[model samples]
Target chain A: MHDFFFYLFSALTVLTALLVVLCPNAVNSAVFMIVSFVGTAALFLLLDAFFLAILQVLVYAGAVMVLFLFIIMLLDVERSSRVRPDVVTVVAASVAVLLLAFGMGYLFLTGHDATAATMAAVPQVPGGANPMEYATASRAFGYGLFTKYMLPFQVAGFLLLVAMVGVIVLSKRLTGSNEAGKPSAQEIRESEVSQS
Target chain B: MNHSELLTQLSEQYVSTNQWCALWPEIALALLAVLVLLIDLFAGRLRARAVPFAAIAGQVVIFAVLLGKLGTCDPADSGLLFSGMILPTTLSEVMRLFFLLASILVCWLGMLYLRKQDLPRMEFYCLTLIVTAALMLLGQSSNFVMLFVALETVTIGFYILVSYGRNSIFSLEGGLKYLVLGGTSTAILLFGIVLLYGAAGDPSLPVHSGDSLNFLALEQFLAANPNNVLAKVGMVLVLCGVCFKIGAVPFQIWIPDVYQGAPTPVTAFLAVSSKAAGFIVLINLVTGPFGPMASLTVPLLSAITVVTILFGNLTALGQRNVKRVMGLSGIAHAGYLLLGIVALIQGVELAAWAVIFYLFTYLFGSFTVFGVMSHLAGPDDENQEVDHYVNLARRQPFLAGVLAIGLGSLAGIPPLAGFIGKVFLFVVAFQANLYLLLGVAILGVVISIYYYFGWMREAFFQEQTWPEGKEEQLAPIKVCLPHKVAMAALAIITVLLGIYQGGFGGGF
Candidate 1:
């Protein structure tokens, strides 16, 4: 059952990811990426990474994807008539296959029996970090995050605040523009004045 | 007992609740960040210059606390926290200390940078703390989940800094490019992590309760299956994502634009702190979570190093934009650091020593060059072109000399810190039998000379005219408090590191 779910979601993820990369229109690609993200979130769940799965939904799907869509809609990006960056596409495709081959080779040589034995030892929770026996992801991760790795957790929060400020500051004001489609800041101001 | 019953018992018995000692640095940084923000919010009531002074004071306190924590963490430790998701040991301690120090310098320069720019100074200081805290976490992360979160935290801060000069379209463009590329890379990183999770997930539970994002499990996982194709694929994708952070080739697309478009002080921070954090995280992942999987990691980093070296130097050759040139050169330097990572695969080697020393030495050198650039670039930093430096030698020989020394070190000229750093890495690579990569690295350095000197030619020898009435464009040869202090500190240290390559226990 686990294998079935893994394979199912893995295939869906790859397919959607492909659509995201191959799709011509920005909106379509963005939508495809959202699907891909959802598939990954589900796959994380199937893998018993409940915390990670929730984070995927909360962070990637909820916050980040919405932002991606927002930018896409704001820009109203259409498919360029240019031929889809053919060289980059081909190179990326080839590299993907090569990496896939390498992963397969690494997997084939792994120690299965040793891993199985380790798995058997997990449920006993001899040292208390064996998440295998735990029913909820939050309990184990929370304990770890708050106690042992609390510093990193807090630091991660700090990083988020900085990123938020940085984005707002960087994207808000533009002094000069040359050789491009002009932003509508002037028009908006004019509309505001007319309204006034 | 039920599974929950068993877990509850073990949690009390083995997972001691006394791990706060391991969390000192992070706590300090977090408190510092909040304190700065609070101070900034109420500076009018408190006092004048509260923002920079208070921020500096807070940072100093955090720095001391972080150092004290580092002094306490045992190197031989294999301790685990939060269900083995975070590990802070010898490696993390070393990285944490370096990051803290770098952030201090960045904050200092950032404060000096904002005085005349008229950008909001308080928010800038506040963001500095926030990013510093993020970088500290990035250094200690032992799991994939934390890795993603920490990486995003820093990148987001950078995006804001890049575009902080909202009035300029160039800054916006840089921010936009970073956002688009960063978002794409993050997606790729997530995909990679999920793939690996799928390949090795536990089967006993309905949802795999033990995805094992922690390094210990990952190490066990890789050594157990050196040939796991799916896992290997995941690792490569992860590396690609990290590679983007470090400005390595292929992922080098955004660095030039972002660096050029960013404010000078911000560019200095980006080049030093952001790039250093990326390497620290890379070292952690390669040596920790991905440690078992050398068959893939070694070759990947080696190849990346080679290509990164060649590409960065070659592209920088033609760049007229000073910032863009530095951006490309930054890529090349990342390649040099990757060499240290590749060497660690054989055994726990001291190759990382060279990388650390180089990062430390380059911080001063790069900061000096960018500091001068910022001063020249003016309030909005409009002039980024190489020709802007024509006759700098004639006008500001002292500043020109300092730039020369910085560029010289970057080009790996002998009797300079960069040369010693290169030699240390080269020896390590040689010992590891990566002769081909060493040869490529040497070639890359040789190529770098042309580009580094190309700028020098404009700055020192050229006779190009400035736009009408821009005589004060060049800084004075006489050193000021800030510039002199920064230059003296970096120069003295760099010369010391280069001349006495043996002792001082620095490259740990």
Candidate 2:
């Protein structure tokens, strides 16, 4: 029964991904992507990576998608006219499809038959197992993140910060009087060029 | 020895349990970051521009320390550090040292660039160290779990830094593209990891011979299950993600656009340190985790290298903006680095040397080019067009000369560092029987020259400057001693290094 659900959800995820990629409307594609993400969460649960599944739902399907939606809504981008397939995109897509077919063939031909015994090894750390402690699998993730994964986590945060700062500096038009007491970005740029 | 005893035994094999030689420099960098951040926080009350300079000075000292460590450190002393989330191999040590040096230089340039723009300083330098530290961890990671975190850290740093000059719509778009694509790639990599983990019998064991996610364990696993279809599939998927990070052919989509769109200093950082780190991680994976599976992995790598070289060089020819050209040329350089990686897979000692030399040379060449770009970037990044440099030799003679040398080196012209790096790679490729890749590389060099010389020609030979855009607010050119010093140092270093591939040593 679990296997049935697993295959069903996985198939749904994959098919929805195709829709996300191939769909004409960007907004529709985004909405479909959220569905695909949710389906993937279900598939993760079947595989017993339960924490990851909840993360998939909460972070990706919930938070990240919402952020993406915000951008889409905020931008209110006009519906893009139908894009004629570029040679590169078309070629890439075809190659991907071919590779996918080969992957499927190889899997079916060489893969072992799935069984329940094989699936039980990495048991899911049950949700609500200690929900009050950290609110989600994020607690263990945090522990691992700070300890073993501290370096990368910190770097990722900095990268985001830089990007944020960079974007702001790039967009803001300096008022003539803004630099009355401060050095203007223009002055800074000229001096930088002169120095180099 | 059992688990505890095994660690003890492993410790016994090394000089000292406390003496993880490869890890010292990284420890220094991390400590330095904390120190710099703390110092910066208190800097406002103390002095003007203290924090940024302190951060830069800290990085400079750390770079020197890492170099000192690299000079004396031996590869045989390589071992897992901190339970092997990070490892210290000759390859990673070299990579880390080079990364530190590059970060220092980029941060210095970034400071000047941002100062020119009148942006905040303390946060800028502090973030650079944080990002550099993240990259070091990324290069040293042996466990995929750590690997993901480290990679994410680097990605996040790049994402934020890329958009640091946020007022530009282009910079914002670059960051957005990077974020979305980066997240997708990370997800794909995780999926690949999960699949591999599921396939392994003892999932808790490190990946080599054991069932865990360790590089050495994975290497052993790969050996035992050479024909394990699942493992192979997982490997390919994981490789795909790493390739994206390196900005190689198949996943090279966002690179040129991002490079063109990002602030010049950040672009320099992205092209050099980020590209070098990608090579470092690739070296680790190829040498340790998938060492035995070279046969299958090598050809795929070679093909990508070939196409990437051809594609990058050819596309670069059409670019009108200098930054865009730099981006495309950077991609082509990635192709060259990939050739070095392909050479290592041949199991030849000479080939390994070639890879190292090529990486160091590539690093210098990239620095030279970007340093010159940093010199020419007009206020508000207005001097972006290729035509902006028309008759530059008539105006800013020194900047023009440095630009020439930088571009010449990038094009692999003789007597430049790029040429030496290329020759070393060609010899290795010949030995490795990668004739097709060698030819593609050679062809890339030829194509590269056209664009490089084309820019040089415009800069030097053109008698008149192209009229500025009607909307352009041309900032009068003012050359500073510090900028001149950066260009001269880089230009001289590139030439000197090209003369002999030995003395300046670093890179993964």
What TM-scores do the predictions have? 0.81, 0.80
Question: How high is the CA lDDT of each candidate model?
Answer: 0.73, 0.73
What's the residue-level lDDT of B150 in candidate 1? 78
Error of 1 at A140 (Å): 7.8
TM-score of 2: 0.80
What is the docking quality class of candidate 1? acceptable
Report the Cα lDDT for residue B223, model 1: 70
Tens digits of per-residue lDDT, candidate 1, B1-508, equal 3555654565564347346555667667767777777876676656337767777777777778666765564644645565555666666676677777777777777765665464556677777777776777777767777777777788788778787655456676787799899999988888888867765565432223355566666667767666556677788888888888898887888988888877777788889888888888787777776888887788777878888999988888888889888889899999888887888776647876667777877786787677667556655564578876788888777678778888888888898888888888888788888888888888989999998888888888776566776777454544477667776677666667678866534543
Write down the C-alpha DockQ for each prediction: 0.24, 0.19
Per-residue CA lDDT of model 2 for B1-508, tens digit only, reads: 1333433343354323234444556566656666666775675576346666777777787777667756585666554455566676666777777788788788777866775564545556656776787788787788887788777767777887776765455666777788898888888888878766655644433332332677777777778767666677788888888888888998889987788778888888888888877888888888887788887789889889988999999999998998889888888888988887888888755665666666777777777767767766755553488777877786678888888888888888898887888887787777878888988888898889999899999889976544557324545466789768877888898899888655433321
Give the TM-score, chain B only, in order for the candidates. Answer: 0.90, 0.90
